[model samples]
Target: MESFGIVKAKKNNKIFVEFTRESACGESCESCSAKCAESEKELFEFPNTLSADVGDVVKIKTRDRSILSYKFIVYGIPLILFMFTITLSYYLMSKMFMKNIELMSLIMGIISLFISYLIIKGIDHKFQKTNKGDIFLEKM
Candidate 1:
């Protein structure tokens, strides 16, 4: 994907870029009375390959991302982890003749979901170090 953003700051070897986040509706407010289809902002860090300065508008491009894989990792993994944890916990609890098996399984499932978040974070950090979806930037 390609986008334009303004450089917000620089720290270490990373340049912080501020982008106006877009919505699925494309911020079309003409037909809507609420006028709530406004844009929000997002901050992203990129390698300062172009030596872009703060306040500069830059064009950014990214590659090496598969949307399907990303979706599965971010959404599917947590769901699968939660379901697996619930099933396993329930089975173990039942085998042990423990009371409140359902409640315990549910608690375990929720905990596993949080753990999945940590796992995803770790994977993201590692991939970032490797620059999986390497971004290229140039001053606009």
Candidate 2:
């Protein structure tokens, strides 16, 4: 999964950053979605946070190949749906209900955002269930 985060703080020449790994449960099945999902097979996470300086743009490199597969389903699907919902709601509500397109679009956008939050939360909960100390950040 490609994730971006700004350095929140720096100490001892080590950068402290916060990044989100998608829920692991999403990868437990054939239809799981969540960029952070992984197969039930043991996942190895490094033990230490990556070393980087505050405000530095750093890339995280992982040898895991499953990230790509999860990204397409986990992130891509909702992104596409969000766009589709916004467009469709605008057009349909405008014609069918005589509502202003902009207003309807705004409402739909908010709805999409809420849905996204729910999805992420669901993933988080699932990931927490597997509570393994192996997940870690490495600076690259």
Count of backbone clashes for each model? Answer: 0, 2
Supply the TM-score for candidate 2. 0.42
- Candidate 1 regions exceeding 4 Å error are 11-13, 27-36
> Once superposed on the true structure, which residue ranges of model 2 sit more than 4 Å away at CA?
1-63, 69-74, 130-140
Error of 2 at 48 (Å): 10
Clashing pairs in 2: 45-134, 50-139
Residue lDDT tens for model 1, 42-108: 9998878778889999987766365456678999999999999999999999999999999999999
Clashing pairs in 1: none
TM per candidate: 0.78, 0.42
* Model 1 TM-score, all chains together: 0.78
Tens digit of per-residue lDDT, candidate 2, span 22-91: 5645444546455455423222222235555666444444334445544664787678778888888888
Distance from true location, Cα of 70 in model 2, Å:
5.5
